[model samples]
Target: MAVTTSPVDETAIGELKAEVRGPVLQPDDDGYDEARTVYNAMIDRHPGIIVRPTGAADVIAAVNFAREQDLLVAVKGGGHNVAGLAVCDDGLMIDLGLMSSVRVDPDARTARVGPGARLGDLDHETAPFGLVAPAGVVSITGVAGLSLGGGFGYLCRKHGMTVDNLLSVDLVTADGDLVHASEDDHPELFWGIRGGGGNFGIVTSFEFELHELEEVLAGLIIYPADEAHSVVRSWWEFISEAPDELSVWLNFSHAAPEPFISEEYHGERILSVIPIYSGNVEEGWDVIAPLREVGDPIADTVEPRRFVDWQQAFDESYPAGERYFWKSHNFKSPSVEALDHITDYAVSPPTPDTRVSVTHLGGAVNRVPSDATAYPHRDADFLVNITTRWHDSTQDDECIAWTREYFDVLAPHATGGTYVNFTTEPEGEQSMAYRENYERLVALKNEWDPDNLFKMNQNIKPTS
Candidate 1:
């Protein structure tokens, strides 16, 4: 059976106000508009009620209220999703934004992170102790969404993905019961939450094991756009034998007006080779030196810097209030044909903000078994993320169409799998995300949330 949702009346609001200590906002409320706004400016939603929970008790109370009232529920952590599932139309919004807290245990090398915390929060807390967690490139992205969807960034090659290091999570199930899941307890639930997204439940807190790191040899090597074809071909062959300590990614986009890039190349299409080496600085230099010779690089800015600063280097580039449409594909390896397609389509972007990134994944990522966690694409060697961003709402159709058309051109080389967080739509596309694990997720959904109360995410359709 499906839930029957409705907008709560005034008397019901008085009752709900007693359930939660935090603010309960309605459409006409003073802060209602700001509460519904999310990271993607393209998303504009109006929830019937917005609940900003202060802690687990408040979360439990809000869930119970929603369950009894049959109000559709939307969970927002950092609110940085491309699909904007964080806010929904005429539902109950559980705004976890107020729960941004981070507690690090220097002795145990672990950190307990609140759902509302961003990647920046995690790094800031752990950096002082010489510890860091593997996460996405963008520091402003929500830790809850990134870790739940299998995070990867500069430390991915040396350490494992964020989910792999996850020790436990405190979740509020549909029953309004707070449960702790880990390898030792509720093992199935633990496995499901690793890459299952928010379909299972609302995660209040995440406990992750940390790795030791202070400085890294990290920077960008820029090449002219005309040399993309040869550069991409050579990059593919080089990363195959790369060590686990060295992680590299390729970006095809218009050059930002930065000091590293030449003045004439600003606003012009260019290819960038970004690398982060976590091993000995001297040894890292030896390994990455050959990359500078791949093509005639217009600039070379690779140098040793504090790892924490490097992680947040691009925070300003992807600010709030920009229309965004992102599409992605997982590949075992991009063939020569795929490389040609990537180069051909990258030179002329639909918008000035459009960016195509090819991230090399292997080493620690491939070492895990396919079904060990809900993240099923362990064998995937590369992930291609195409981002189309612009300021004007009128250009929405043009931007979305370009992203889809470009995605279709590179479909054959893909592994028929996708990163759950990167996809923009639901339904037929959901199957590509979980692959062989789809059946298992369906069973979990039936057992945990039988009525599908939490269907705002990359939905796992129930067989009713």
Candidate 2:
């Protein structure tokens, strides 16, 4: 606990805390600031050392001791990632959160997982085998950084993207070696880590490919942010005939005073319409009855739950040191002048802790084929996440200039992709989050991280 004074050498940090059984911390130990906390409480990092591995041979002896002590590394799995790319200020954070495990099999429908699993530990170990795994709808995110930055939620319009039900990945690479990858092993590093976010390696284990799903006819369909322009044009005309067991999401925020929201519209601005059908919950009550009748809702919690309680329904509006700021976009079928600049920036707000989200990318994420994996925005039909959450750090520069001035006012009806799992800091031109799969992910990062030492995510640089 309180130990201080480290000019790097206490028998090389006690031989990396005895070759990692787990727990290594050092900024004068005692859970070094909760092992360098992450998930963007405006990322205040400080890692002179902090391992906590406990698996895949302690992440291969902490990536071969951070490449023979060259240092600068950061990998924490479920520290919920909001672009604090898991934590690294002094260098070397590798905290794979005690390698949280989740090993479902249900007669090999699959689900190995554990690069510090989460998404409520693979939906509580595959919901007693009624199975599932199309990830991220925030049950404390991180199923290995949401299937390496390409996962989608509410059963991704009927399972796809969770790196399309992953299927394999053992990884460690960046020279620490482990390997495995899928579609017939090493298949171009499983199409560059499927959507390539941890750029070229560090995976550790994720198999996924399960899907049976027993419950879901999810809820939330609020309104009144002055009924956000007929609820964003009835959610762009009900996602142009959405159906692959339906899934919706078109938020805009404020109004969570809870008690099922109607205390005179609590904090005001709203428009939720969150739906999730995943088939037969009595036929998802007639397929979400016209999205529960679009605009007149001030609240409507659609029924038949248990898809792990609708994946922890927004876990108390994301509470973990909350100070966040994010911006993302990738639309290609949204015009009516981009839904009037998106229901006018979804009922305007530079503060009521801004929100704006929207997700509905075509059924089975556009029948996958924008180069089949490395997540090329399969012609994105919609995926905007603008969140600018806050708790005051002097309102981070006017909530990051209203999310970069409404992301440059919806940048020319955007389609220039971006969604490195809703990236936060690794400013743009990271090949716009792999458009045309960014030169084959920079040639799979010059054959698995050549000198790019896995540059803190959303990176793909090595071509020398």
Alpha-carbon local distance difference test for all models? 0.88, 0.81
Question: What would the TM-score be for candidate 1 when compared with the true structure?
Answer: 0.98
lDDT winner among the candidates? 1
Candidate 2 residues lying further than 4 Å off, grouped into runs, are 3-5, 8-10, 17-41, 50-75, 81-92, 97-110, 117-131, 138-140, 144-225, 228-250, 253-272, 285-287, 290-292, 296-346, 351-353, 356-464
Compare the candidates by TM-score and give the number of the best one: 1
Using all chains and alpha carbons, the TM-scores for the candidates as numbered come to 0.98, 0.37
Can you write out model 1's per-residue Cα lDDT over 1-464, one digit (the tens) per residue?
A: 33445667778789889878989999889988888999888999889899999999889988888888888899999999889999988879999989999999999999999999999999999999999988888889999999888888877777878899999999999899999999998999999899999998899999999989999999888898999999888888888889999988988888888887779999889998888899999999999888878979998889999999998877876788899988898888678998888778777778878888887788898899989999888998888988888999999999988888888988887888889888776516576899988899898888888888788898887775
The clash count for each model shown is 0, 0
- CA RMSD for every model? 1.2, 18.8
**Could you give candidate 2's per-residue lDDT for residues 1-464 as a string of tens digits?**
11222356669779978877888877876878987887789889787888888788888888777776677787889878787888877767887877778888898789888887778878888898798888887787778888887888877877778898888889888788897888898788798788887878788888888988878888888888776786777778877887878878887888877898869889888878787888888877887787777658877878888888788878777777888878888888777888788778768877786778888878888888888888888887778888888887987998888888887888789887788878787656888778777898898788777777668777888877
How good is model 2 by TM-score?
0.37
